[model samples]
Target: MTRLSSPAHLRQVRTGNMHAVLVAMLDGPASRAELAQRTGLTKATVASLVEPLLGQRILAEGAVVNAGRGRPSRPLRFAATGPVAIGAEINVRHLGVTVQRLDASTEFERRIEVDNCRATAADIVTRLADLIRTAIAACGRDPLGIGLAVPGIVQDGAVVHTPNVPSLNGIHLGDQLAAELGRPGTTVAVDNEANLAALAHVWPHRLAGDDFVYVSGDVGIGAGIVIGGAMFRGRSGFAGELGHVIIERTGHPCPCGSRGCVEQYAGLDAIFQAAGKRDLAALLLALDHGDPRALAAVETASAALGAALAALINICDIETVVLGGSYAALFDHIAPGVHTELDTGVLAATRRPIHLTTSAFGRAAVTRGAAALITRRHCLEPNLLLPPGRRQ
Candidate 1:
């Protein structure tokens, strides 16, 4: 027996009209002409797409109010009530999970701390499945998909490589966890944490444009790239492995078998070790107490980070850079050194316009980006919202 009948699923897929409805709502309330202009589809095409969606109650039409000297425009908007999607961000030390409607209004949220990233892949899957099940029970919504943002390399929805964390070196983390969840038709999506943070942070400021970079420092360092308004996950899905890039040939030994890697200096462990503390909070407390050693370590890390960012600016030329993660709070202390490096290292022609700022979402941005990843753009398709067995 075919576990899930394709013909039946296809019929259901055709009935929902979710894609067209979501596209309409994304443009805000608009008339046919307004939506057409914003979406770049002809007015007739917009009408054709919207009619079925309207019938399904996914798209709502308002009164055709009269506009003087023109056709009365009937505005359309997405129905506020519909299926909601869940986004989960699994980091080295914690998980940030959120649930929101397809229209982007957030519902409930929760965070939980699990075992260290050193936990075996099986352990990770079991614990993650439990967390997700708990979230589903709490949210009480039909989840369309699950988006996971992890601190490592992702290719075709799997964690094929995690350089900083040895236990996850070769695990197909996504597929295993998805299977453990027992939601066969549920869509599971995965991406590097930095990439998701970049998407989550840049989406709100998208009116300014899409080309930007997101850099985060935590247990490890990572970067997410956005070019031409879309994530550019380069060949082999390791494009943004900025943390492993050799900064100094003989600086310090990194666990990834490299010396003087960015993570050796910019990662939380390095900062803590340099400050002679077990935690970043303790180091910050020492800094507050006028502990010179702690303060010096912070400055050194900042200068190294600044130099690295400047080098990247010379190469990528992104318009903006957003810093995130557990160590993002250090941006305030290191701004001076970062400024100094950017002033000196970036090419003169492309230097002045680049802006560096701390991420507004802080540690939660990567998780939010994971959620967005499951539902945004050409990425969204019928299978995105389909039940598990029907999905590829």
Candidate 2:
């Protein structure tokens, strides 16, 4: 078998072709010619790559479409039943794990409290793997991969520095979980949870376009940068650190070692503590009843969020900004204030409307994005979640 040569200028040709075809099939079913047209590859070249995928049961061909006068054409599609992928997102006080098919449609999800995320590295990984395994088992599918989304700086697909969860720092989580799971075909990837949430905001819209950003405000605050429709991991692969952006100089202390950082004011733990709540539902109810303390927390968090958005929009100038995570719903209470802040802080106010929206997928955004990552990794390189010209 002749191996495809890596393009001297294109980095890796086989990988590129494989990813392109896989992405196309994941989009739905398409004929070889249609794939060629979509991927800009010759039919012969596409077929060569498609053969191996077919042999591996990764790609399936079915149903002939009569092309007016020619013989029926068999369309290529991805075998969703081939394997399953799991995504685990660990928040400041909760653990969320989800299992979904390779095509990214979720099958089962489980979320529970971990109290203090300050547990030791081994303990966190061990427990997280157990929860993920349970979810995967419930799905009744053979797990093919796992994606871990944690807070802090993720370097080279590992949790390098986690300020929120100190014990997770310096752990090669991807390697550790791969050993623990012991599934021969299972591989693991790790990334910043905020980055994953950001990607979750835009990943589904990639098939349409990739010019958006997601501002994730949960227990902590952070932003995900997507440019040309892909998660833009900067020089260090930890580009979206929106939470730590200094919004105030002397108001509150932040875990990221800064005064008045956005995380300090808008982080969930801080807000919940200030509100003196043991259950989030109770606090939300209090906020609904117009409790002064709850309302104050919401107002303070929203104002800080609005200020952060203003700064982010002014700097990045992306088309759409999505607020995801637990605090996304609070946007309604603060949109007016946010609008005022945006008008004052951003440049050329009228050119791009600065459409601020909340995640349609709600809390499930990150897990869904993890599913999206699985599709991106095992199937295709280009995105396929949204249709072109319809991403908003």
Candidate 3:
């Protein structure tokens, strides 16, 4: 790529190039020559970028290999102990916290099942704060930043309101957590649960597609959308409200002051009630036994889920849809019916078949997403995580 005339533009291009090089390294260890080929940068530019990284001990050289025809080269890999990030989440049925390294690997994670919706925000924050401390210590190093994912609409690190879980409404969770944790450097972030789910889909899971929708199913249904390798947060950052999408006009009433919404038909309660079972384990075992009642209930839930997803797919035109949370666990029992509806329901099914799959991260998706959100910057631009003097 050619540089612009202005120095500001030149710096921007170099930053972009630097980020590209770091992303290439994320795949695995490689020599400078290999990094040049992967990032499409000249050897000289790659060397210049590597200088600052090497000085900062962000990238370390491995044992030299003599297999090459021209010359021996030492493979360079991300330094494991330089810095890390802590990620945590609060959902209807659980709370979790985790620590992740700059190389996109989990250092440690802890999860607890609790009725967060019924608990007070202060109490939940206390427990989450404790977990965050535990996770930080578990990492065996200090964290550079921290992030959080919550089940409500978050704007500027505060919870506007949560319909399904009212206790979290009007909670400035981000500000409170930041004050509680007292970490500096402006890396803390607060976002919706499903958006974090989408972020997790990209990293740890490595789902193959730049654009896709992740549907979360626990106490309610949530959708996280990715567009152009980043989240599509709409004009007000309130996009991807998949749970409230209307499916039946005169059906059941929803907490959102809407009738016959997707959650009413596809949420955990709907499936459990349809199967005449209250617990998830019992329902899964019954389905494993090929029980007719369990199969029918799953079909009922899948049909509604597919119907809602058909609308999402038509509007978004994304071919990939991942079922996370409880939906992912039961995707096998529900995939067939969901596919049947998609085959007949979508406007362009023949052109692009909808690929339905389960969340590889499962229940732990949000926590990992929290960490990925912070460390992802380091993946793209290592300078983002380094101190000013150490950065290129």
Candidate 4:
């Protein structure tokens, strides 16, 4: 006689089936029959799985489609409006928020420039909370969760070390933001800004592959590594510290108390210092005018950046490198130098060419990436749509 399955086992199986159904629709709409075929589940089981999703407004019936011989069927698509995810960022120069639906459609977004380096952690949290509150009001619904991007090492929802924004050091930013918003129950995820920016490239049909390293260029440099379609946070969640990769044994000083780090040579500040530009806008204008000093500065930084990246690629075996943050703006000038360095530095370059590209989102990548983390979780675990007590 066959033994009955335990409740826990049954719940696990059901959750997997639901996830399959949702993932099958990522390309577009699908009927129950199509979903059954794609997910390897019976039509009846597919129907049972979709009912709650439809009822919860997570999925909606689209216009009927006819495949000539078979009966007409209405495809199921993600609802135009449903649970939304909020993404926020705390950068040295800006604070930002973005609200997005499960379909990846942005509902609300705002960014304000500020001298966050000088602001206290409490003041920054207050301003960011107000922005989140405004986004919630504009969306007219409570977000499913919030993802925060900060420029530093993050551990257990707290910012353990942020060299650029020291005020946030050792702060449980996620909990503080949630409490500031008076929604202590809301889930807030905090992570490295570069890591989140890298996620943004992967989810919602942005990046082409599962393995790559995203290097963020700014006042501080960081990298985000993606392998097999998921982030590789390494043990203790402090893996992608690209900025601190020592290129010189005794070069320039770093805020992290390290000397000759890559950031001292390739970070935006270094480039600006070399070019004598006050800011990114001025530097871009100079580059546009074919300014010799600006071009030279970019070349020097690119060489240093390439050396650091070559070492990372050698170890991680990542073939694609996407330059984000301020680097995106300087891509045209920097790519050649970086390519030259990679060709000579990477051992694997003899077998395969490394692909280097610029991020489409530019400075907006971190914020958008923060939002993607929430949407990704919602997609993989649709049970989150159910009431707290009812979720398996």
Candidate 5:
């Protein structure tokens, strides 16, 4: 062991070593020797670091593996039951909660439809807190932390602006949710839903590669930009406001006080109005029946969405785009129009391929991404798994 005179320095080294071990295990189960080789630490050090994690129920020993020549070793894996993370989302049409283990396996999940647009911020927070509590109870464990997804601009745990859900503007949602949950010092991270959704694609695995954009469609439209396998929140943390980008100077009015924004044409509300459908289910049904109105509505929305995406791609120089939320549901109906616009509007389309796809999670992507935020933090800073008094 390297000796350090300062206690803080020793703690920092230990935390770093522990983080290395945890991150190595993220690939799968590994023995002490494997961890040592992967993290470039001595086997003795790996054993010492992993002991506390096993004692704390963060890691468990799996079946013994034969090394061919040496003694069989027991592989260690993330425990299936301990130190779960909570993910919650507050959207215009619904509230969702997801509890996931360190391995990214969902343990408990729930989603409920509600007219959040008609509710006050406080009321919505109360409802979201209830869902979180229920999830915690269902999981039967205290969450290591909570991650919240909201459809708006977030800066330093506060919502700076949310045009569709106006009540949340200027609210420090993370702090309020932590207080409401009666866990004052617990970590409650708040971020734009689209950003989180984009993260969900990257953390466990890079579903969209290192450079890509995730565009979310709902009652509001937004984009989550990823570069170098990390989220690209601009200088002010309000970078991916794809909905506000102007498409038609004199087009339909938008809630963000803009005219001809892509959201005005491509958002679910606009599609419903154009298709004469009451809700997504109805619109999906209309599309299934090959109704001309529904097809036309989707075609128009897709063209506008593609145009906005073209501008985003041109500026960011990203080659991949993943359609999420309602867009994922309507991919078959709307993809051709988006593809046509991309081919025409994207300057590099002829030289480099532009890949467009749908999110596997659909609308649940936001909540899943929120959960990943917590787990990723824990993996990077394993000291967070310790009791407050012991974490230095």
Candidate 6:
């Protein structure tokens, strides 16, 4: 069988025409001819690639539309039903789970603000298992997989380290959750929240050539980097620990056994401390109303973030920085401080404008991206999940 080369030059590990067709459809609904033209595949090749998807109910045909005159071509679109994907996030102050289908539509969601920092790993896993059960029920069919968004480093199925949630450290969360759920064919995948957050930008958008930095601010701070439309996971999976970047040589001690780290100054806790407010909602309201204290505290934290980002931009040469999590909510108020610090710290800011934007997924970025990870795996390379004797 002849393999179709990807038109966009993506790193496709599998040799097949299916990936090309799916990638073309991501732009929008397209007819077979349109898909073939865009993907650089022959018309017959497109039909062959699409046949399996249509049979599996992964792709559906819309009504026949008149283009020129002779024959109307039915457009192909991602099916909204069946094969749902699950994504979960374990935050210090919240637990968020998103049930999404292949088309990125939310079927069901559960979010509760429960402080799990002090909760034991077993307890956290138990809560997540219950939530996963609910999501699985909502799916009502064999799901693609479940992806976990953790605030810590994840190596294998275990949490490597987390400064914000110490109880999660050294816990085999993926394996435990799989064992607890005990549902056959329900696979579990895990990764850092920020890394998945970065993947969110590229996943649904399908902008494989974009290069940017995604910074997530919450109880803690972390970064996700996208270079050439792919995630730069670095030599180790621990690449984007932007929070641990040192800002002051002898400043406040950090939970990661460091002093003067970026998180110490710009993290949610630091901003809350600076504002003298125990509640974030109240502080955000005050900042919106132009309260002097709230403004000052947010500005101070934004400056720290900018300082850390300057070094990052220089090293990565990324022009875009996307603020996610709490940062997105406070973007209007804190953007100036980040810009000012960038102008001062970044060497090439004068030549190239440093563009900043808010995440499209907002606080749900990580979990949604986690779900997208599984969807991407299935779309780009379906052979891994193929049933025995199922022809590719």
Write the residue-wise lDDT of candidate 6 on 125-178 in tens digits. Answer: 888889878887876875778899999888877888897999999987777888
Q: Each candidate: how many clashes?
A: 5, 2, 0, 0, 0, 0
Model 3 ranges off by over 4 Å: 1-14, 182-186, 203-206
Ranked by TM-score, top first: 5, 4, 6, 3, 2, 1
TM-score of 6: 0.92
TM-score of each: 0.83, 0.83, 0.91, 0.95, 0.95, 0.92
* Stretch of 10 with least lDDT, candidate 3: 178-187
lDDT of 2 by residue, 1-392 (tens): 33456345343565577677766665678898889988899999898777766765667888778988866889887665555678887777777888866566677888888853668878777788788878877877666577788877888776777788888878888888777777645667788877787766554345224677787777777778888767788898767787887888986887777788888877887778777776668778787888898878767777777788777777778767787787666667556666676777778467767777778767877776766566556555322222344211
Per-residue C-alpha lDDT of model 5 across residues 164-211, encoded as one tens digit per residue: 899999999988998898988989999999999999999877888999
CA lDDT scores, all candidates in order: 0.73, 0.72, 0.82, 0.90, 0.91, 0.83
Off by over 4 Å in 1: 1-21, 31-37, 40-48, 54-57, 60-76, 202-208, 288-290, 349-353, 377-392
Residues 129-170, candidate 4: write the lDDT tens digits. Answer: 999999999999889999999999998877988999999999
User: Where does model 2 exceed 4 Å of error?
Assistant: 1-17, 40-51, 62-70, 73-75, 183-186, 202-209, 380-392
Give me the displacement of residue 34 in model 5, in angstroms: 1.8
Q: After superposition, how far is residue 137 of candidate 5 from its true place, in Å?
A: 0.7
The CA lDDT at 343 in model 1 is 74
Local error of candidate 3 at residue 168 (angstroms): 1.7
C-alpha RMSD in Å of predicted model 6 compared with the true structure: 3.7
Report model 3's TM-score to 2 decimal places: 0.91
Residue 142 deviation, candidate 3, in Å?
1.7
For model 5 the TM-score comes to 0.95
